[model samples]
Target chain A: MKHIIVYIEPKDASSLKRTSYEALTAARSIAGDAQITAFAVHGSEQALATAGNYGVQSVVVAKHDLLSTYSSTATAEALAQYAQSVSADTIILSGNASGKEISPRLSVKLKAGILPDCITLENDGGTVKAIRPVYAGKAHIAVQSISDHSIIALRPNVFTAKQEGSANASISSFTPNLEAKHAGVKVTSLVKNEGRLDVAEADIIVSGGRGMKGPEHFPIIEQLASTLNAAVGASRAVVDAGWRPHGEQVGQTGKTVSPSLYVACGISGAVQHLAGMSSSKFILAINKDKDAPIFKVADYGIVGDVFEVLPVLDAKLKAMLHS
Target chain B: MNILVCISQVPDTTAKIQVSGDGKSIEKTGIKFILNPYDEFAIEEGLRLRERFGGTVIALTVGSETSKEILRTALAMGVDKAGIVKTDDILDSYNVAENIAGYAKSISPDLVIFGRQSIDFDSSGMAPMVAEMLDLPSISVVSSWNIENNVITAERDIEGGKEVLTCSIPCVISAQKGLNDPRYPKLPDIMKAKSKPIEEIASCHGSALVSLTSMVLPSSKRVGMIVGDSEAEIASVVTALHEQAKVI
Candidate 1:
């Protein structure tokens, strides 16, 4: 890649999201001698400056009144316009909700190809090839851009955000001429799940399944999660039975998580559920059935009933983590 | 309100997948194909909208001849019409979006809907890409949707929580898992759907922008250490997580 543009999404009005930093680190890794430019819309000076810590040489803050509120069309228009002005050949963004929503539009605007939710990217003799999980992590496919310009969305929590340089990124502003029609999709409001960790972004997760028997028994799973400071997860069956929210469902139709540690409680490890979390760094499966498929992928397996095993596990972890 | 619902056929989630001999695609033999799970919600939403507002619900898919099965499923689910852009080649998302957008333009539907993502590719790019191509506003992963007076208010999942968005007609939506429970086709409807005409459209074969290089199964590197249900075994797991895995 010659000139790379890394799209930055603000966590709030002032700071960049953790995934944005990881995008910068990813761009730096594949950039080689290429110039890396960080792009954002209506971000604070403090937020733009932090890109330097992630090895960005310069930053471009695109500005417009309509752009202040996140609109897929308007943001994509600004990114496309700026990329064209700078003659950038590649655009890298995080594969979070906003990024996933905008990257495809940006790709179409720039007449480029997109590699979405990519886990690994390699520069192969002047070509960038990426490996992304398909079929919900059951299989992976190596892909490359056949178009002149390419857009890559990196999967969250996969790439490490590292500070390779100690220089501040030079900041510039670009004001794209946008019309009212461009602000077609408007975010009226956001309802934050305060204090609850999302499984998609959590480092550790304790998940329940059909083996939990009933929704009333979930506190056993939650206590263990609380003791570990991890997020709570559930199997599709549990979520379907109204025992958990859809957001906490971990499986083919739900969130795909690759946390540092995953604890499966009462989950039987259906192929669909396994497809979502088989990539965790460490897995601990607890079940009464000794032959449950979850043990095949778990690093540690404790064969016992959840009712009997969870309290002890929670107490043990509480003692270990606290002491 | 003319609604257009797009869908895809994917291998059953429970079906085992193997990399084909070409090393670039999955082995399809002995695999049972099913309607993409998320698309069920898309089709259901389309049917519900048609029931509320007077409109024709059309289902479309850009895939090979085998994809017509999903169109039949949509027909059984009460779609007014169905069509397929037939092609055998493995088109990338760009071309797929191009064809779907092409059909949407020809029909000029007031609303376009799709599943959040296809289970096979799992890219989640269709609705937005097609929306951009048609130059219309779009919302994705919508869990709750309300429409009145050509205005759409939707609640969708974001990273940490829910986001409420509003847009006018001539918009696009992608359904999330919790949108609605799709209805299964009855025996009579399934029989009636078999006779429904599936209009075959010519594939708009554009040069693919992205190409698959290879495909492989993910290798497991887990250290499978099994323990009994004893209190000591439970304690040992905590110790292993603390010292050995060091994740604590």
Candidate 2:
């Protein structure tokens, strides 16, 4: 029996993210006998076409007024309906931003158990055992739910993207049974940083800590990230200092990122911060303090000033790209 | 208009947590419970809104009797009422949400507010579930809110930036930090909190959506190599990256 993956569509307002495609490839690993269904809880024809490229067996859009605005409650209720409709034994979700907000609720709606922040998933007999980091990033624990319909939220970038084949699944719309009170809390506005990649969805990222001094020095780190086409991240200290927004922070209290390449310019790698990004495929550390905890997890270490090292590395990368 | 604030009584971020004798959970000895930092922002916003527009602020928590102590903390900060859905054992996030939704259904407040996610479990799902169970609109990671008659203006932090939203009232909004600095409880307010009305509810014992079979502490650090201070020592250190550390 193959596992089914559900790429929960947020209320089709925001642009589609790369994590959606990455999640489809992850579902392929488990989608064999049981076909995978990529669901759009509140998407339109344009959103459906946008989701087509992600290699999934089918894209089912639950067209409903209840989904008019994004609500974890509405999404959970809608996805629960789909899970039962298809008799899906295993449901895979992205452990990034949206998944963290809704997976627990969806599991409740379906009376299922979820293994969250799972970095790997495999079939065990009829059960799905998942590997996830626990007690921060110091250890990895394997969880096997002794229950029916296990929900697993995979960490971003943990599974390699394999979209060679297009599943090109059928598209359908669903209307949810929305209640009036459910529409009570409405969003009035939005604010966001421009050009930078979604920290959780980035393939490469460069983060700075309070060691970066202030917001004035963040531009250097941004320059390095721009050179690599990577994302920008910050430590709690920097965020608390008002040098960066809380969204850019990486820690137990911040956004967790698992990029292919992670460059820590001034971060000391506090346990909380490491819990967010320690799963990266490769990590590079450049700090003035050699004893920074980040070096413990780094694949490459550079002990020097970030101001001096960043420009040099940026130049080297530019030269390599030009040459 | 009335506003309900769902608050979680969590261990202070600075609290020292250690494994118990059996190594199964955080040691409970001498632990103090406080309002979840994120929820404090929610409660504070509720109070501020009430002050400006004239509404009641009600604080609620689902936890043991001892956890209710945090309610006084909220009351001392000028909240109108406090409620606790009594429960013991590690109630999973889903069950907690079910209990909260039940509470919301009975009270039927015009507006509900919650922290985007709690510090524990890190699931951040309860308020949304309650809103859904009641069939209300909810916005997560909400950093700002402005109310105008029947409509509410909210700001949600999305990937790369924020999206300004305009939704009607009677909705759920999860307060993100930085939206406002939680007001400190003054001496007079703290004294008056003892007189504030508190209601205790029976545990709903609803089935939780997720469960933690077990929890264990992380492994200890293997070894840490320290570097010397000085410009001359830099070259030898670079050598260790390729040699001893095998990281270059």
Candidate 3:
């Protein structure tokens, strides 16, 4: 039987990230009746309890005083030890910042096959096959591992989280044999972007492009996003032009978001920008240019000035939501 | 202090990408190649670090001879030297990391830097894997950094915030976009870069852990309808989004 492990990270001090549950769902699809374990470092009890509802048979937490904060070396060392202890044939993780930092180190420690940013995965008669985007989402490539063990990082928002009854998963704790090297790196402080939701996790995103004019004009975009309870995103042109923070960028070189609703304001669509948000369920484009490429993919397009259209749309939304 | 920058050559961001007839690779005809934009930040950071601390910055790449073009771009951006780990085969992330780690071990630089992720593969795996192989601390997606004495303090973005990390020298850092604005190469510097000799080393070969089976373009998006430009018409569109699309 194949043994699978999903790495779960805390969304905060108390809860697990939604992407972790999505990783669990991916793990379940791979491990039919076989063993599936949820692994976390300094994981809270609530996080473990939630993993139990997602079909995991066991949960492993690596606890240590030094792990109160994230250290890439320490986390990778702990995860590698746990994988070896369980003889895990496959390991899955969310393709978040932490996962991107740790999975490569863990893969090296275990000498396993590694695939990051996978959008689709299937168990092909015990050998796992995955489909991932390449060339900045311009194309998709199918890949399979040739190693004894495989490490996979699933992109966030792609996999749907599903719970299958109560698994009653057993919990266990282990102390990793960390060395002095693991302590070489330390996180001193964490400053949250306060009040702003991450674009990758938001259900709806209202993104601005170069047509927004300057950094000062972003407040209007922010106002609209706040009205819809959505995150703010910017095209690469604006981000590179220093009109927006890089974290807010959505395009080939920035965050790829697959939200339920993506509203583009004053954005002349580039293929690179479309690659990032084309997966949205509903795209709404508002631009003065009638022939902008964004209109082609938008569920609804408006050829009007963003300054004029945005206020009307914002007002209409406020009226509809009664807020 | 010595610094090493890793870079990749990729098709221009706006290039029209087409899948090859064999369905295994991209058609390279008439494609304009440029140094990966993210790597530009790395090259710029390397140059800035060398300026602050007396050191040499060496730019490296693991690819075919054509990849030397990227190294030349780095040289034009003020990197002291350039090297190419020449390989003709399609190496996986593991092999790529292994080869880069081998070269890094030989030079033993004070710091190794890379772009957060290559726009082509979007792997974002190499820098950390190289660090693991070298048994050094690593920070990926770093937006800002400072070095006091030998300790490096770096800030990187997380889910909804930023984290401040500290590590000593001989660490690996991947440059995020907001780190700095990359400098444009002057005509004189571009000409000078052409004369610099690139040190080409043969790459170590190993069986790739993951192999590509096939490649295809993403499914096409739906052709949408254009609503009118008037306020009344725009209101109708928003109403349709709420009632008909049920997305609002």
Candidate 4:
């Protein structure tokens, strides 16, 4: 791929999100001496300067009054305009919520094929091929783009964003041709979930299910998760029963996650649940029933009452981690 | 409102999936296809919008003849009409979005709705793609929303939080799971829906933008260490996670 443009999602005005660096690293790996540029609609000079550590030498910030408030269509128009002006053949972005919204519009605007939520990307014989999960991670398929221009959205937490070398990122500005019609949707505000981590982007997850019995007993799960600095996850039953928010649900209908470590607490592994997290690097299932289905897919299993085992486990982990 | 609700039929989540002989598609035989679970929220939202403001809610899909079954489900759920862009050929996301946008262009609906993503592909790209194609604003994964004076205010789920957004009418939206509880069609409505006519249009899909080259099941080999939860066993588990798994 030549003339690659990586869309940078800002964490705030001062810094870029971790996923942006992941996309930047992904682009650099497959770039093969191609010119790599970082593109963002928001970010301060310092935030844009950090792209140099990820192997980008140039940055293009789209400047427009409408861009101060986030609109997927307008932001996409800005990126598309810049990509077209530079004749960029490849675009890369983080496969997060914002990227998911913008990539499709960029595809339509640029007439480019897109590979969404890709876990692996390889450039084989001048053609870029990608591997992405389908059927809720039950299976994976290898896909590729045939169109002249292409977009790739890398899944969060999968690609390692490491600084290989440093370069001075040259900052430039691009003004997109936007009109009143372009500002169709405006993001009024963001209601943060406070300190809770989202399962979609967590490296470690401690998940509870029907075995937890009720909403009142989730502190044990939460405490253990806090010890590990992991996100708290739940099965569909708990979410449907209103014990937890839909954001933490992990299953076929809910979010699919592949964390470095997954601890399934009191969860009887349903096929649908397995479909979501079987791809985790290590699985630890804790249940009282020795014959629970969760054991079938777990790397380690503690077959005992969670009420008894969790306290001891939590205390032990606290000691070990804190020490 | 003139709402357009888009839906798709997918293999039941409980069903096992196998790759087709072509290595590029899934085997359909012996699989029970049902209305995509997320689309139920979309259809319900459309019906509710129509109920709130006097309007027509038309359920639309792009698939082969068999896909009309999902339209029947939408009809039973109380949509005013149903239509399908008939095609048996396997079309990519771009092709499907093109067909949906083409049909949407002909009949200018005040609002278009879709499931956040199809379970089979799980791309979550259609609503935004079609919105761009039609040059309209769009919101996806909307969990809650309200309409006043033809302006829509929606709250959508994002990582670690939610975003509140606003757009005028003549927009597009995809329903998230918690948008509303979908209604189950009664037996009488199901029987009546059987007789409802579904308009069939020839597919005008463009060339595929992406192509699936291969498919394979992920190979996962676990350690499969089972231990009791005694104090010693608990300590051993912690040791394993630390020294052996090296993940602690």
What does candidate 3's lDDT look like per residue over A1-323, in tens digits?
37888899777665678899899988888777668888888666766767878877688889886676778889889888888987888889998888998889878998888988898998888888999988867789999888898899998888888987775667799898887778678889989877789897898999999888888988889999999999999998998788887889887678888888999998888988987887778899999999998898898998988888888889889998893
Best model number under DockQ: 1
Candidate 2's docking class is: acceptable
lDDT of 2 by residue, A135-213 (tens): 4554455676545777778776687755555434567765666665433443334455656676866778889997788
Q: Every model's DockQ, to 2 decimals?
A: 0.83, 0.24, 0.73, 0.78
TM-scores, each model vs. reference: 0.97, 0.82, 0.94, 0.97
Residue A91 in model 1: lDDT: 96
Name the runs in model 1 displaced over 4 angstroms. Answer: none
| Second chain alone, TM-score for each candidate | 0.97, 0.88, 0.93, 0.97
Q: lDDT, candidate 3, residue A293?
A: 87
Task: Kindly give the stretch of ten consecutive residues in candidate 2 chain B with the minimal lDDT sum.
Answer: B222-231
Kindly list the per-residue Cα lDDT of model 2 for residues B132-207, writing each as its tens digit: 5666766677777788887877776665667676667677778887789898999988888877778998878555
Residues A199-284, model 1: lDDT tens digits = 98899999999999999999889888888889999999999899998899988778888889999999999988987888788999
Clashing pairs for predicted structure model 3, backbone only? none
Interface RMSD of each: 1.2, 5.0, 1.8, 1.5
Cα lDDT, model 3, residue A51? 83
Model 4 ranges off by over 4 Å:
A166-168
Sort order, TM-score high to low: 1, 4, 3, 2
